[model samples]
Target chain A: MPTLRLLAILQTDCPTCRLITPYLNKLAANATPIAAVSQDSEKDTSEFVRQMEVRFPIQRDPGFALSKRLEVVTVPTLYVLDENDRIVRQEPGFDKTALNEIATLLGLAPVATPYDGAPASKPGCTSRHLEVQTEDAAAAALDLHSPRGAKASSIQLADSDDPYEYCYRAFGDALPVVPPTAERVEKMLRAAARDPQEVIARIPPCYGEATVEKIAANAVMAGCVPEMMRVLIPLARAVADERFNAHGVQATTHFAAPLIIVNGPVRRELHFNSRQNLFSNTARSNSTLGRALQLILLNLGGARPDAIDMSALGNPGKFSYCIAENEEENPWEPLHVEHGLARDQSAVSLFASEAPHGVSEHNARTARGVLKSISYALATVWSYRACMGYEATVVLGPEHVHSIHHDGFSKQNVREFLFENTGVPLRCYSGDDPGEGFAQRGLYKEITIDGEPCYQKFRAPEAIKIVVAGGTAGKFSAVLGSWASGPRGSQMVTYPI
Target chain B: MPTTLVNPMNERAPQAAPAAPRLATLQGKTVALLDISKPGGSVFLDRVELLLKQRYGVTSVIREMKPTFAKPAPAGVIEKIRGADAVIEALAD
Candidate 1:
């Protein structure tokens, strides 16, 4: 085999170099060659070549010193340097120029075009504009020349005529999913810089490995596009945080799971529905972003029904529960910004929680009255078995925000008001009804001291985290309290993607 | 493959249980009632406790109801069940 030394120097928009790369690849395949990239290469030249599926011996130089040493100013520079380091001839660039012209000079027959009905002279490579034309032509030629074959008939677990419905039934999924195919999964893979095989975290109990590829597959199954993976990856990492206690969440009868909150420019960029119908399935990002998390839970973590996760009457949010912080409407700072993150930076925060209970305050004329209603709802502890203590989150809608802010109420003020007034007296929960599992667990009794029940007392002001979200439509906000978080009480974890 | 079907000339069908008096084996057995809440759970447990004593020879039934439903069940509940011969979770609303 003969070794040909080739060097290509590029500009931001080089034509001849683009046209010759594929030809060089073909030439390299027929003969041994060394392709050294010059430092003066275009910003995306290497990437462009990679996308074109050109595979050949190549090197890149950050500086064009090599090109200068070769004294090759004109590009698409073709030099047929033999193994002995002797230049047979130096062609400034190819332009309908030939192997025959060089072959005649080197005493060899003109090289054939490797294609049928080919001419001795190909085409002028001098015209930089001819690259795209010939490149498309060559691509079409390759497509025609390549062998045609039928797809293999193989039944895969994730494959079905009705992939979404089938996978949902197979996994006993709470919500339907978009079946993940190899092509779609591969698309999701493009969102991350991480290697497909790199293990991000291990799912609890089942100890299933969650690799970048696996998460991407689940994201695809969850109907996530490549762009959605940016949000999904961070949400997965947040829940996988050891402090999140995914193991206990799945194993315990508590119907609590991860609640995703996004903060950053990505919210607007991804068009997260933080406006009207924010939490509803009204927008693509809203549904798919949340669905991506669910898919990861089902396929990667194996949190299937009647299986590892024993959630009785599992809430619909289990399918996907995520919302972007209404940074624009928040009276103070956004949730992420309040947590010491930059206002403009993007991040994902996970909180262990149950389904949200709406606190409607449509008639409240003043902030105090509205706070009283919210406080009443916040104190209603129906789940007395929760001994790990209690933490509440207030997701304020825009209408509610205006009413409260107009009355000079801050989010902290709302939290304090809820902390001070929300709980009911112990007697309200004490009863003969058999379904009161929380009181039967002695949670109220634990809060009692000195012969007086302290159930009405606020455990801590910090127990309540107030976040503003939802659409601007109604004066209704939701009060979502944590399930019995057990030993590992709910913790908010934030991760940057 | 052809589907197969059988037709019986007699056409006898399965019969339901007869209306006879049947004795319940759960009678006279001591049961433990535990829950995750206090007042509401104890109310349910009280009814369960009364039922156990009246219908069965459960003269001495120990009952424990948790204080809060929001927290996970404590270790004591499991330990109490371990000592009892049988346990019934008194789930009350």
Candidate 2:
């Protein structure tokens, strides 16, 4: 049975395929036998057929088997085959002259003209089968294990649809995210070396189960390299710790977010930025690691800004706030070590805090002088009149640390000095004012400083935390005010990585 | 063939729970006013307590304050409020 026919390989999203639809219909109307192969899902293929008013018989190529077998590289590839299945003529894209020539060969009048309001020629989209090949290559390079047993739900995307746009619309943080394709997620899961179905933590508000697979997907979206999974695993546990009060942190109408501080050998190994512009987007490790946690909170935990996250004046740190302790330049033990972890051990400390307030003391040359200037700023934590209930972190710059360390001030000495020296003058509180101040609450102890009566700021020296960071060139330090302190509020949690 | 991606969101289907039965009336009933411990939450609840007593004849108004406003009500607080015929919670910022 020898019969000549035309074969067209197409995908719904290719513009060239849509452009050539009318010409293909014209040929079909001319009594030409044609078979069209659609490299798309059944749903998408049906829509294309109905919308384009396709007159020819079309068949679905599941998994792009037919396109792969035919070695098709570009979509809208038209082939004129003889009765023996030998190619007589082929066109890869839309070309009016080529279509007219093919029409002439079929003993028909010209089917295309310049007045068609279409381009004379247009390039075609790559065949869908090629994407699988590229993904397979990447998987092999990463030595990824089987993803068949993955537990998370899967979404199918047509080859023509923009994956980035689809991801943004579906699960974005009002910013662009990397598409969490199966291959990329699998790579992260394999690196984690943990069961994909293992539940790390249940995020609050929605209490979504953050399985390893889901976290990997979010990490992929946050643009994290696979190596960061080790840090992220324990970090997730810290967020879910009962003492952290994640439910309150997520739902509160206050400026509080989990600030991650990385310490130990992993900081150097992962190249986390602990130097100049400590909190800026200078390092990929610092930026992506922080972003991954936020994505996890937003996607897996469902703490969407418009929904559960009701911070009145949302802090910028909600976007990404992570830093490594500059242990090399630090005069005191790193924050994690001070909290009882070994110096060599890797750990992540989570604190619920507001944004950093920079303090400039370019004129101070002694530890006493530096503490006095920082104390003035520290006096305003939580509120100018409120005291004894808040906590703060003093991110001392290298230059400031140098001055303090040169004066032989130990870390404890620094904490004690800040606690005693920081206060609000009693004269600042008016008698007509309500009971917002500690003076009215009967919680204040008056002390004289420079012959002026003032109320002490923090209840204890331990309420102030200190960490060394930033460039040695600047005398700038920063103070991060805590959301709330003690058992009732969020307590800083640290977990070893 | 279509491209497949892993779902990055929490995939658990949300379970539907029945809402609590509504109170028939406030008169001659005990009401619980829960102040979430925010700065102005107590003031809001104070007015609510006054209105409930003056307008609805609510008796035995019990006032409860959470340790902090940032978290859910503690189990003890929830149990205490469970005894009330009606409860009003203030969510002032």
Candidate 3:
């Protein structure tokens, strides 16, 4: 015997739909199980249920995502699917004869005096789905409901039950997350302004396909608003870049996290703090945007703490470490402009780095003086005497950026100064065991400058990326060392938002 | 009142390939010793290699080390180890 399912697609705003709603109500109340799919907001759908005395479950289409897929051409399109979910019969418009046939098919007595004191037949209003003619666009529009263009299932829970517990059982990372309700995901999808089924990239470890809808689910869990989707979508793509080494980063024993820095006009639009408490939990966009990416990696990529993510000592940044460049406060070009993106274009740069260590230069007034203190802080990147030729980010506070600029040093000048000054001497590279000594001495790495094989600090001048952020009151800067700087580990990736 | 919630997990089961046939004996066989690069791994594998050569009469021994202890080995490393009659890989802490 085939399982029975009846779906009635209707719009409360349509008059012909209102005329045929009584028969739909009768079928719902007495005949069989029916779900009324309404192409309207929940408020309007609930009002329609009350006014029309509808007893069936009113499923909110919210964005018309389901209506477009069912190809509802009119206001009153009805469908009945069998055990295999294949449509057995479809009825359109208000017809008394069609109502009688539906009642008989549902194993009810044939309708006697159907639509009493009503017209025999009436044409329904055109479906809003047909308003968009292109099939590809229409299909893309439905991605919020069907992520990756696959069939979706929504489970029902008791209203008295806690929603946070529902997400924490399996899809959580030791934190209570906002439930990724269908309505919430739909709103997030619309904010992204892209196809929900669009494949951003395949996340590593588990290598799960990260569709826009799936990514939005994670974003919703992170307590992100709809507008934050604009930032999170591009961010979801940045981790998938091979240069970022997200695969190795996930499976590594090294303490590495995806460090993100937002630049250009979007910082202000999203209210990212480029000033005081920039790296702290000062802005909703900054914190949740970073948290959303981590949630995506955990839920979609399956990079759990005890599983593939084998960080020996995971950093607090594993929760979230995102900050925007203080573009207006900085004297030099913003971080994105250094990466060749136009200053007007909003972009995000992803770096695989450790937690930040503060570098204080309170007494240093000149550029070289500040650089001297910063080089020691930079020298502690991979190891104090290791001299690892890896990348490091120098987050210059607003005061330090101005102090360096006032001394006539550009961002490149500062990077070059750090590179030339930071090194461990040949005499200091010795220990008990030769093999241990070589590994500890930052061995097998040397840069020749002025006819001297000086064991240099970084691979190149640009290895020291200078990002100017934080407030102006402090004479402090921060250094975040890289995990592994080349193909050996993750490199920095800049994605235009 | 009852409310409906959505399931946020991948419902599809993982697709795993079938295992290879078992080997009967180790005599005159070329065995591979793979180290995951973890601490104390080489010491354990050294004793195992010695036992295979002296007691089991293994012909040749192949050795390989994973790039890092964190991730799985590269495809080339796996193919190299697969050339042996039998392989012993460590899971050291």
Candidate 4:
């Protein structure tokens, strides 16, 4: 007699699925007995397993491949496999009473694991699962449920019992979505003036076609309004810009991306928070717009985490890291204006940034004095180590900005001042222990300065980039360092929307 | 017309014989050592070069480098590799 391996593929939300999983678990617990799974409602299935204390392995098939392969048209399908893993008995929908009959055929004892399931954890304001505010709740819920490409007409609303909600939550998408209703999407589609099918950006090596409509759908999912799409289209173009190098940013194990910096009237027009918590999720414009770009990158460009992006420790920035420049506070010209764009024109500048390091100081009273403090803080090896020919971005808060401005130094003067002071001495660049294995690798070279053998040190002054950002409250400045030196240096590229 | 169920015997392949062992031919091949100018990248290439020189007598080496490590590999890198026998990329540390 051969052993039976019943692969129970069931949906977690189905009442019938919940009823039969325990018995199936018992069937699978034996050596070469069975393999039961709930492909749909993975959250409920995981919760069910935790609650029932089912020790048997229950694989989730979100892609619905295994279900389609076994011709499973219904939930709780049990496929009895022979010793060679061939399906001998295939049946859709679970039946606990049939276990005895099926057990006799396979010659196995029915041993159901005792139910000792854990309760659901209390939801709190942990960074992972922050609740959407009530005002934005309806829209956010719709965004998740009727994701952009979902059926346009009469989009299904997520009720308390919607299985899709649980599925979305388990997949790390929130429980609800503001479905892109046909009425809303059509309005947005009309704003574009191009055919919905018109291709905007060609996603790399996979060569997936991303049309304007598809990008609009993703924008809808990210909770972006249609007018934002004006900015989105060009921003997508910037990311796909051959020099922007989206492919290398996505493919490399190192940290890099297209950091969108908004300048001119659009920052104020879109209500992009250049103020308090500018980089954080305080403002809808910053959050959704940044999220829209990331979703397009993840879904359209196919730069999924751990797949194309092999970041050692991927940061929150990978989700979405974008901000607006505080143009009003700066004494010097705006970033776009500095890059040759008109002062009145709206533009977006893109740069590849590493995660930012926050430097806060309270004792400084004046701008140049504060920058000296900031320079000391910046020059400190912990936040940023000066690299030859590499660039770092300094985002200044309003307090630091006001302090610097009151001292009568222009932004250019400030940038030059930072460049001159924020670097370690030439002696420190040499390896303290030259006998170290890495030092012996001949990676670091020595220079004969004035006929004496000394270590080549001091990064070029242009490497330090100072840009003003943040709220009007604290005396804090954030520094984002360059991961590697580039041939073109860190030149800012701008696109006017 | 009736469908005929005729079984065709194996005529192309002779009676199953033990397959010959396969070996990689990396000897006497001119290998290109390309660098992107990053410290770790150059170090990794040097190690590969050492192995190729010490173990194998393939001494004809061609070396080139991209100006900066952060940038993409220059246009000629792939063409250079395409002409060689096998190309080993030292991506990063």
Candidate 5:
């Protein structure tokens, strides 16, 4: 089987593809042997070639499968591959100069088009492979071709008429999934630069090997488009880290979930919403990304709710909890930068956290006042004293950030202030102090050992992490406390994206 | 048109850990009660401590509480209680 050197990709549904069919025939007639790749069914392509009176062999690309690999976003795309299959000269769309250049490359006369005497140029229609139908179709186009028949574990429900059968039979996370078909999952895998068989980590409970291909299938079911694999792959790796203790996070009955905070260039590249509705369902990156991780937990990690995941009052974030740090406007170091990544490097910070509890502090005018408003919220983390040495995230909105930044407060300054201002009085630690029966069960009595009632809030300045996100209009902040922080539970893990 | 998706889950059967051998009796043995960081977990463990002392004839008892309830206990705490003849982990809201 000799590999063809010159290839012209087309679709029968495109008028430009039809207009250029004769020009392609003329080139083939000149002994150049230019192969026209049709992105249509065999019947439609044969009909097109028959109608055009062209004798050239038209190769069939059913479902535009091969066209997707050539990065053919529009029809009438052309590629001049070398004998070694390297694309030496490629032209996208129907530009006159590009067509003439191709004609020169094939040693043919400058090809004339249907509009050569009129406008001398024309625009081409969209390619069949890149059709986006929904508003949430914000993921970027994968720049590689999907392999044909590359699936191994796909379950074909041939007799079942219902397409959503997988959703009900334990594969679904109590929500309808987008059905991770082989074609869609292949597209998802193509988005990542990593190998599909590259094992990211061992998912817990089930301890399944999470290969790039396995995670891609879950990302597809979670409604993530192909490009989201950029964010999801690293996000999956962070949680799968044993230091993050994904197994403990899943087995615990606490209201814990993976809260992902994006940083650096990938946040903007993926269009994550760090402004209004930052915690709400506003952006496809925010919603589907966290959901993809959760789906991985269900499918690979085996942390299904009402089973291994025994949250007493499960937070809504279990559905999806991802956000980007407003790195553009942040006055302090971004989460990733503080965690040893370069300032410009893209990374994800993972925390085993409960759902966010909003801190509505509308009246604070000073930086100290803002910290004070947040300190009270920090005091309520994990039952006011039962869970000590835990962590919490204070998400400051743009308005609060402006105030804090104006007051010359760094992240360390805020953490110190919150740590000092947040703890309960020593009286609460003892049983006799205020209906002190709680001290008997195993509360840390040595946590506060001062002569007076001065108690310490967080274990260290590091535990009170400050992240800037949310809308600029609101003066609100939020507190997302840790879920059994320290070695006793899952610690935070951040990875460069 | 209907979509055909591949299974993302790991179908391999999870290797189950063998169960610990049951203790025959609690007579003259030290039993440790572990309290996770939640609120009512300690009260539950306190009651269990009384039952072990009164009914089981345990000679000694050690009670340890995690610094925080939201996570697993630290290794140091676990190591301290690992030597006990019997152990009971209590969990509550």
Candidate 6:
């Protein structure tokens, strides 16, 4: 007498697989001779069995040998084999009607009911063996040992579905993103030249592992070119550094986001916008690279805008805040060079800052005139009365830099002059104001500026970070205030690319 | 016909740890008040400590503070609080 058996191919991560567990258990209870194959590691398979309360025997399909032989394209696929091992019936995904028909064919009662709470029908996840790969030169350029070894799981979308809409609905940052197709991700991994499975950082507050493959997927979604990986890989490390305090930056109610400042040869090599429209969407590298990091933080770090990210009145820079220093127009050493890196070495600096506060000093011909105007704006950082504990990045326009440079004022001189002159007048602190007593807290020193008693804005000149950027024609400079500074708060971090 | 894409998210298989068993009674127990270093957190914990000692009959109260509210309590702080029978953490805006 020939016997019959039901074969089920599934993966632990597939939602349909878990959904169909009860039906499979029902078949098993009926003595229908069911054999389930799991395309997952033994550890995961065992966990799945325990969690789903699986009743049937499940054999692990190492290397997906059986799945490939059976040409399985989706999980929760069912095959009814005859006594001769010939397939009599095949079912993909979950269909209530199809399940009932199979139950009837097996001489058993209906497996699923309308009251089962399961959907009438649902598509299954793509079989892991069917993951797509590119066949172009870009794919050939990838190191098979690295990118193919990437550990990120795969998701399958129907060929007719709109990938853009699907990606936006599922994985977007409130914006349409390029679908991170496997081909595009592989191309990005090629540029990284690192193990795609390597964990770059664990982003807070969820502390998700920012693996190289995951970063590449985010980069693809942000529409970044392959070359941008050079900067992004290091930028990830910088943000994860304890001194950067990403948890504080992401969770604080204050308006703060990680600002990426690029310097050195890579800036020019990537055509990063350092001159005209420095902070705007003028350069692809500037726009996409900045956007990539934001996506990484959102997707991998789990800093969803409506969830863990509690920033009130979030800065527009959160969309994309990246700029390269205008090295040619800068009078002092570039930001990277100032940070102890050689002039030719490329590096990325991460700073937790609020939106840029623009200062129009168009008429200031002399360095002192420009510095004085900037000091007034600098005093307003954090709050006019709030002093110490905060830092600011002074992004000077090239025109302003030229004016200061021509006046024989070095970068150190500019920092010291700003520190000495930038202060809140003692009279501004009204007795009834809540922040009035900050000056007496011993956190700030009272200095006489213009013969008026004032509370100094910064504890030290080093608190002011200056970088020359923006169009050579514009007289507008900007100040980005820090969230919180020092050991307890976020500190600026620089990493070589 | 289906198109495939890599998952951009970090796959986390979080093992659910069981919560600590509830104490039957606070009598003769030592309660730890943890202030997360946020403003007003200490004031809230102070009241909690008083209530635990006076009303709940907690024999002793251990007052501890996290270095900052922005991150989790350091391991040293957690170890210090582990000696207490129960801990009440104050989170103040």
Predicted model with the maximum DockQ: 2
lDDT-superior candidate, 3 or 6: 6
Model 5's TM-score against the true structure: 0.65
User: Candidate 1 regions off by >4 Å?
Assistant: A1-176, A384-388, A426-454, B1-93
Q: What lDDT is reached at residue A482 by model 2?
A: 89
DockQ of each: 0.02, 0.52, 0.29, 0.01, 0.31, 0.47
After superposition, the stretches of candidate 5 with alpha carbons farther than 4 Å from their true spots are: A1-152, A385-388, A426-453, B1-3, B17-93
What candidate 2 keeps of the native contacts, as a fraction, is 0.92
Q: What value of lDDT does candidate 3 attain over all alpha carbons?
A: 0.76
| Candidate 6 C-alpha lDDT tens digits along A261-380 | 999999888989888887898899999999999998888788888688877789898899998988889978888888888999998998999999999998889999999999999999
- Model 1, position A160, has a per-residue lDDT of 29
Candidate with the greatest lDDT versus the true structure: 6
Candidate 5 chain A, run of 10 with poorest lDDT: A141-150
User: Which regions in candidate 3 have their CA more than 4 angstroms from the true location?
Assistant: A1-152, A433-437, A440-454, B17-25, B35-51, B65-72, B89-93
Look at candidate 6 and give me any clashing residue pairs.
Answer: none
lDDT of 2 by residue, B1-93 (tens): 576899998876666656668878888999999888877787788888899989988988988988777677865687677678777888775
Q: Model 6: how far is B61 from its true place, Å?
A: 1.9
Using alpha carbons, what is the TM-score of model 6? 0.73
| Candidate 2 lDDT score at position A460 | 92
- The reply for model 2, stretches above 4 Å from the true place, is A1-150, A438-440
TM-score of each: 0.55, 0.73, 0.69, 0.61, 0.65, 0.73
> For each candidate, how many residue pairs have backbone atoms clashing (under 3 Å)?
63, 1, 1, 13, 9, 0
Q: Give the per-residue lDDT digits (tens) of candidate 3, residues A360-422.
A: 888888888888888878877876655555789999988887778899998889989999877
The global C-alpha lDDT for each of the candidates, from Candidate 1 onward, is 0.60, 0.83, 0.76, 0.60, 0.75, 0.84
Query: How do the residues A214-286 of candidate 1 rate in per-residue lDDT, one tens digit apiece?
Result: 7776666666668876776667657766556666566556668677888889988888877776768887887
Task: Report how far residue A276 has shifted in candidate 4, in Å.
Answer: 1.0
